[model samples]
Target: MTHEEKKKEESHGRPEIPAWMRAVAEVISAPGYERWARQVAATGGCSAPVRLVGESQVIDAGTGEVLHIYRTADEPTGHLLVACGNRRGAVCPACSHIYQRDVFHLIRSGLSGGKGVPEAVREHPRVFATLTAPSFGAVHTQRERNGKTLVCRPRRGGGVCGHGVPERCGARHDGADIRVGQPICPDCYDYAGAVLWQAHAGRLWHRFTLELRRQLARRAGMSRRRFDALVRVSFAKVAEYQRRGLVHFHAVIRLDGPGGHDDPPPGWATAQLLADAVPEAAGLVQVLSPDPGNGQRVLAWGDQIDVRAIVVRGDGGGLSDEAVAGYIAKYASKGAESSGTIDRRLSCGRCKGVGTVTMARGPAVCKRCGGVGTAGGLDLDRLPVTEHARRMIRTCWDLGGRPELEELRLRPWAHMLGFRGHFATKSRRYSVTLSTLRQDRAEHKTAESRQRNGLPGPESTEVLAHWRFAGQGYTEAQEILAGHISQRAITARRIEEQRREGA
Candidate 1:
């Protein structure tokens, strides 16, 4: 074949463009999308902008007559804009980047005082704390520091369990060990308990927060209700999955004066006092099950709970306002998929289909162990539960419940088990709200657009725009264009930042 023919064949045989890329390209090539196209290309086409292929009706205010019908083709239907809520990294990295940035700003605003928060908040006693789950069981781990290797899990005598499986792992695991999530002995791990723990983690956190507030009130010799009038506690927390596949939390807790942002705290509010209250409250707090499936289960914060004062500037300083904000923002964009679970729901039919594919013809060998007749079983040894997968399953099951448990329902996070708390949660008084920050960003964007378009500003008549979700994603051709746009935007942004710094 000629070189041209070969190239043509290769192009024809090219893998179908990824759905995400296709979606992005479609938006980039859409009407009035020059700006959005530039954005997508700058992000390396990692984001497929959502499109709104609909019509908007503009009315005459005085005559009450329809002035215009703005169709998708006429307006910017396929504009390459950031998908507002695509959380998965695989689907939309550009959108995720924007989200992460927003989270950082929201968090930082509270910490350092912007977006309406008082600047003096920087002086407030704050802490970047992590609350861990209690030990469910030991699993293989890798620990290395300064060229020293740590034994994976040293147990006496390299013993055997009741199931005759090795009781310990002697291999020195490296950071990339595939066996990291697998249990040394599946039977020894409390899989059921771990699932249940995930289901109730949100409740456990709520209880802990309440207990902390109560403790603070008692310490200050005031009623819990009265304490709210004097001092307020503000906190922002993010849930993180540990190597063990369990969910833990990192939080920034701050004490503020009553009346929220405008008021100053009483003289009694101190970082030491808040630090003392956290541990005492964490230790004292417990969530009890009046009716667990098998028996009553009492859940408490792990003994490893850490609380440290977040100094603005000092040795052993806690996380900076910006650092904490950035950290929380990064995690907020993640989902159970990060932990290794399926991103979308598996239909019963699909689940059965997967089972049939693996098990119907004959007993297939297990993926983990080359054991026959174990492919479709729930046995951890055969189909070892990945932390991500386990969390996904648990998240799904917990989301399905009777009316009694409806209050605990986390629908949007049904894929994350019953833990429907915000990816980053802040107490009311701690700092600026996510909504406020977002509004500020929107306003800034609007102002910038006006400036770029050379449109009249504050004195001009009210301008209006309407939008609807046309669709999400892009075509292969468009994705390429988007990639270019994204790269250019990023480069431009960096250049702009550098110039500002130089100036």
Candidate 2:
């Protein structure tokens, strides 16, 4: 059998106890198994947990008397496990689900106004806008109308391109078709332009926001300075990867008074005005690509810009506030990995770049792949990605080596197809920050723990903590146990949500 086939068979082929199964049995019967299981359960079964060795002390601030003490050495295991807060679902589903829920609350608060924001902000002018990348080449796209799929890129003559590739395709591609995002003519595709556009997408978005303010000012027949002083622009946006391996921004743009959400915007600042300014600003904004070999190229937003008015209720035929918030939150946990890219970075195959590999018996220094991450590494040529994404990755690698394009750092972000921007971002005045949300949750948990333990409040005590990173992730045996816990947690959460909705 081939290597892939053998690996697949080993996972599900027979009922015999394999080496991994034997390891699982040993782990389950180990002395510290109960403690390990409790730690894993507390982390919500994080796929990749961060391991830490630490000691903490809580002392009375006024008297300097020791109040409480904790150490990893006291636990059954030598380390403490913390969830790796990765937002990408492909990397860690449990953590991603938490991140998604947090994002939803963040966005919803900015709309309906909660979590330290004023309720009056919900009455302010706001819009849901989609800014798309300019097309570099004709790609296979799925289109539907009136409950029926339409032929993709149909043409009367069905002519051929300069590369002797067909210019038109009549097939009706379904959403799951492999050719849904591939180029009709690979040779004729503008790979360089596409990569450059992707690299500069963040800058393009920044420029568009600036131009939007300018457009709003001009529409109001006021100077830019006066407009800035009178009104503030707040937004929360998430980047979603299109099927063609490019990112498009979906944003909730709002107008507020100069003092922020607490103050009312000018009377003229209506949702209709914001909607009118969006398309004009997107059409006007442009960014210049790095002049690497090819002369400077101008990149701008695509023609298919969508701007919709956000309303309090969807019953009146406008996009609802909750709908817009939920839509942006849903895409927050996604990345280029959704487009068939690997979730983790390529590294040493044997040791996985940690300089050591866990053996059947115990951990051992890897001699086969050495300590360097590149030894026995993945072959980029054999990556199981789409042809379009492969070309984009190759282009990023090639351009990354040039001295002129060094600032883009394309090599490290090849998995993202040259897109190096954050998946979710927001203006300072938009709402509560992700860090703030996380901090609040942490404080709440700490308070609950202190109450349960009959410990003093943080205001009357001082805490000192010392921690060192140990390692991350789980062994084969722990992974199986954690996976079951994670599924159970998800099912429980779903049931709770259904119950709440029904009530």
Candidate 3:
């Protein structure tokens, strides 16, 4: 007997198959299964694909000839499947892998040369810098004075804290230890201040940029305004969440002439010059916690600041361009998933008909409980199960209501723990954008499709299409199948990445 038949026979005495499973079985067994499978796989097996119901007509722009006509009703599933396009790996690995690659190219293009960026940028003054968050409280950490592995923490009397947590860990803790970044005492950890710091991290980075420019100007013997006329400083940065749930900055800071990329920087601009200014700029920059209604508080970069010169091929003082690009790109697709938090937004829906939240224009949303998109009136008690997340969400709600903090919009981003900034960002001239890359890809795919059908190119042909969102995700059996497809895709992507690295 065939393997499929044998499998079915072996399950004869098992519990009845679910209806969704039966549906999947029938769909796969249908006459047009191959075509249907191909269409589904086109989306790279997105677990939750957006279903679009619509029709399209490809016409000849010059001749008014109808080249191709398509309808949603004619599709394998009577709906068009589109990739959800979520950048977070926790949400969609297929799409996230794509995002990671694009980010890599974007960063690489600025460092080396490609996608219209000049190779001269490689000679430009650039530094790979890491700016970490200040210490919130004493957490378990492995330290090394020189090359020797030092003790985690040592105390004379081995006393305990007020919360009864040990003051010292005599054990030589490995980097993988669960308590590595966790508070020595959870009660002693300043959770509120950490969340607040995350909320204001964007402001801190902004001020740092300003300070860096000022430092550069001082070194050039010119005012900040005069320095702007001479040269422009560009940066591409990514925010990474630490094990302690703090956001740290990783950046490629570059200096270019007034024309940017096209012109060379002044003779004074050098790798060493930029590297020296980083710590000085970091030291001078500070952001105050919004009148916490308590006392004065100043936030600055932590003691562990690293600035390395990025040399091309031969000489090297620090990290290489490839390593820097790979590192930043790797973190572009990661979100709150690293911090034991939800990457997707939650709402008041958790209460289940505690009455839907009515939004200002439409229905309200209990942001954390998953009610809707609105997040004004959620009770801290009704939030998600994690006490850790609940407290952070509460801070978002409470701080959002404060008049001085309104501009920060903490309520809308409560799900993000008050940090509303993009995970990755670049200056205007860093490189091509993700949007431009996507459009180019779309055009290439269209060209390939046209070649297959022996049709004219887009210059003379145009597509007029109408689409609507129908639904998302898959049935039980389909979900199982999709997981298999996703695994295969992940494997394929990894192989491609490995091949590129080897080359």
Q: Give the winner by TM-score.
A: 2
Model 1 agreement with the true structure over 124-223: per-residue lDDT tens digits: 7788788888877777778777899887877887888777888778789887776775667777776556655666788788888899999999998889
Error of 2 at 99 (Å): 0.8
List candidate 1 segments past 4 Å from native.
1-46, 55-71, 75-82, 88-90, 145-147, 290-293, 314-318, 347-414, 451-468, 494-503
Instruction: Judge candidate 2 at residue 145 and give its lDDT.
Output: 99
lDDT on C-alpha atoms for all candidate structures: 0.65, 0.86, 0.79
lDDT of 3 by residue, 77-125 (tens): 7888788888888888888888888899889988987888888889888
Q: Model 2, range 1-503, lDDT digits (tens) per residue?
A: 89999888778856767888898888889898888887887786589899999999989999999888889998877999999999988889889988998898889889999899988889999999999988888999999999999999999987999999989999999998989878999898888888888899999999998999999999999999999999999999999999888999999999999988788899999999999999999999988877677678888889999999899888976889889988999999998977766565554556544456888999887886565433465566678898888888778777876778878877667778889898899999999888989999899989997898789899999999999999999888888887887678667776886798599
Note the clash tally of each candidate.
Answer: 26, 0, 14
Worst lDDT run of 10 residues, candidate 2, spans 371-380
Better by lDDT, candidate 3 or 2: 2
Worst 10 residues of 3 by lDDT: 347-356
Error of 2 at 71 (Å): 1.3
Query: What TM-score, computed on C-alpha atoms, does each candidate reach?
Result: 0.76, 0.90, 0.87
